[model samples]
Target: MIKHIVKDTFILQRLSSVATENDSDIVKDLIDTLEANKEICAGMAANMIGINKRIIAFQDNGKITVMLNPEIIRMSDAYKTKEGCLSLEGQRETTRYRSIKVKYQDTNMKVKIKTYKDFTAQVIQHEIDHCNGILI
Candidate 1:
């Protein structure tokens, strides 16, 4: 099912249960929403489709990618970043890995791997944290 949780409510933003062979709809909904909303994410500098923690910024690269139930497979040394979450309303200090490699299922249920660093790392880590039930 596609569960769109309320932002800043915090409780609803948590690690999701692993998708079985059945959850194709949830994945599809997220992908459709994300792909359709790329322009708005760029315009606002942030996009929150489900929860603020799932919010991502569109890079100038002209693609909006959505990872369903993404998991971080690797992480680098810790670094501090001033973070902004749509749920939190403002920036806060959060220490997190400086780089990460994530594996997520695409809309078609094909697993995809992507590495992230710098600001991209920040956003990915934030989103991953949401998958783990942490709201910052």
Candidate 2:
């Protein structure tokens, strides 16, 4: 089911907890919500849907990818940019990386490490920040 976008900064600002296999339903809801808002949004954190879990779904290449407990292990080539959120009123300026290395769990709770660059990396960084209770 597509969930409502959370706009409450108080909620979005709270740190997200680690996700477990039981949170699989949240992964589905995240994907469904992201797809529903694909025209205007690229990604979303679990907090964005009123669930403060470490899960994120984003448009990568031509498909949507889900990550649970995503952490940026390494980041490089930082630059400033503005971003818009489906739960925010307008775009905000913030720093982003051109490349990033992340550690996260898949829906099945298997750990995976991956490198991302350019826009994709930026998107991941933004969502991870949401998990950390950082808002731009």
Candidate 3:
């Protein structure tokens, strides 16, 4: 389980490495835990930014989405409407993005790349910025 740190105690450092052998198990466990938890919806919020993001794979078309502390290292010229975050009091601010390509490590410690477009990409970008200590 992740230790959800308080705002004052939150730190913005790179995440630690998970054991290679235990990655799948750990990610699965986390996915189950989060999915079972009624709060995963809100836990899906920026509150997870500083919190250790648990890796969870989406079952559709074998999409493995391990989003723990994922960051967007690059962005395109596209732009989208700002999304609201629970931690931010649900105020939309119009964050900018055209397209975004993100680099992240998955449960298997394998590097992964995902391309985002329009609003979806913006959400990812916003969440990534949150992981890097930018809030808005």
Give the per-residue lDDT of model 2 (tens digit) for 19-90: 999998889989999999999999999999999899999999989999999999999998999998888898
Better of 2 and 3 by TM-score: 2
Per-residue C-alpha lDDT of model 3 across residues 14-131, encoded as one tens digit per residue: 3333235355555655455335443423223223423344332332232334565465778768654656553445667665877887776665566788876665566566556554
lDDT of 2: 0.93
TM-score of each: 0.67, 0.98, 0.57
**Residue-by-residue lDDT tens digits, candidate 1, 41-124:** 221111234533232323425665656557789998898777765445677898988788988776566888988877667767
Segments in model 3 whose C-alpha atoms lie over 4 Å from true places: 1-64, 78-80
Clashes of 3: 4
On TM-score, the leading prediction is 2
TM-score of 1: 0.67
What are the lDDT scores of the predictions, listed in order? 0.57, 0.93, 0.50
TM-score of 2: 0.98
Single out the weakest 10-residue window by summed lDDT for candidate 3.
55-64
Model 3: what TM-score? Answer: 0.57
Tell how far residue 99 is off in model 1, in angstroms.
1.7
